[model samples]
Target: MLLKAKYKKNIFFFFKSLLISMQNFLKQFKPKKYKAYNKYVIVSAVYNVEKYLDDFFKSIINQRLDFKSNIYLICVDDGSTDNSANIIKKYQKKYPKNITYLYKENGGQASSRNLGLKYLKENDLNIFWVTFTDPDDFLDRDYFYEVDSFLKKQNNIAMVATNIIFY
Candidate 1:
């Protein structure tokens, strides 16, 4: 009986040491964790809205948040006959890092938005949130800043809506 008890204690210690060493060995092969920047992607289905395109782009560009790093704008043009595409191209040239311009045959707003989502998935951007906007709709200067603040506080939320002020 004494011999059996001693052997059991030795086996227990042996397994414990083995488990610790295995854990340490596994840690080395673990995936290296790099700091991730949570970015917000805004998708806008743009049709022929040449008149309002400047205002829309200005509102987005003038947001208080760091436009270059914090926010990304995906503008999906739905075959605009007007000079809307030209305006988008202009802005794209000016802010190439912050804006992504996609041209697709006219299929309505929903399809354009879906294409924007597909682009997001294909690129695999580190996105924390996604929201849709209209080409004619302009945002307040502090819009993205406020949204970012609220999002940081309420990470559990899936959706957020802002009061729209029709001018």
Candidate 2:
């Protein structure tokens, strides 16, 4: 019993230390205020989304943010099992370094977003703004700029949203 208790304590301490180390590693990557551009948008794309791929990518590529201030667009290909990957590939070719990709196994939408978030967190990308865009929807150019600009200028705001229509 005495030996077992000591072993258990050692195990507990080991795990505790491991957890702290992981936290520290993540913290190191935490985003700092960009002297030039401190904001980012995490746009995600995944499998079986050919229907909405073109409009979606186009919308992002055409964002009107102050390009002088970098808007890091972190995009992902979540193990798409369709021409979805091909379409995303096209975007990759067209945009070059504009889009960042995190290709993962065949996980669902939530997984895709989670993977994207992991990349964001690991890279310490200070994203003062993020908005979800449905792969199957069309967006106006002003969507993100309006949200980001409005949020940036406001000193006392909590939440912002738009009308949603689901057929």
Candidate 3:
């Protein structure tokens, strides 16, 4: 009986030590808590949509969200022969802090967008969400507001998409 009690006590101590070591090992992999940043980044590839540029810029500026601070517009001009680059420059001048314009050779839409992503990576801002738009496409006034609401409710969402209204 004495030997059995000693064996049980040794097993208990062994398990306790093992649990402590396991917890210490797992602590190294624990995810660090990050503060929530609600900044929205919009990247647009402009080729030759000068006609629709005004509407696109206006729609983004008139969003119901904090357009002045929380919203960022990245306009990538993919060698547009039209006045698209000028329009982008105008918006960039008007809202220098919120709008960024980048010029590149006549690359495809994907390449232009990739440049925008590269800019995001280089800057390394604490952006909560990143989205894409087109120069000829416009968004509703409450679009960002609605997206923010939905994202706030769902904690595990990796991406969120909205319906497109084709006219």
Clashing pairs in 1: none
Clashes of each: 0, 1, 0
Model-by-model lDDT, in order? 0.84, 0.66, 0.86
lDDT of 3: 0.86
Model 1 lDDT per residue over 1-167, tens place: 23456547688866676799999999988543222135688899999999999999888777767677677899999999999989999999999988999999999999999999999999988685898999999888777777777777775888889898866
For candidate 2, lDDT tens digit of each residue in 1-167?
23456547688876676799899999988534222223656567566788888888776656665432555556577777778777776777766655676687877788888877777778776665665565777666665566666767877766678666566
In candidate 2, which residue pairs clash? 29-124
RMSDs, each prediction?
Answer: 18.0, 17.5, 19.1
Best by lDDT: 3
| Model 1 spans > 4 angstroms off | 1-38
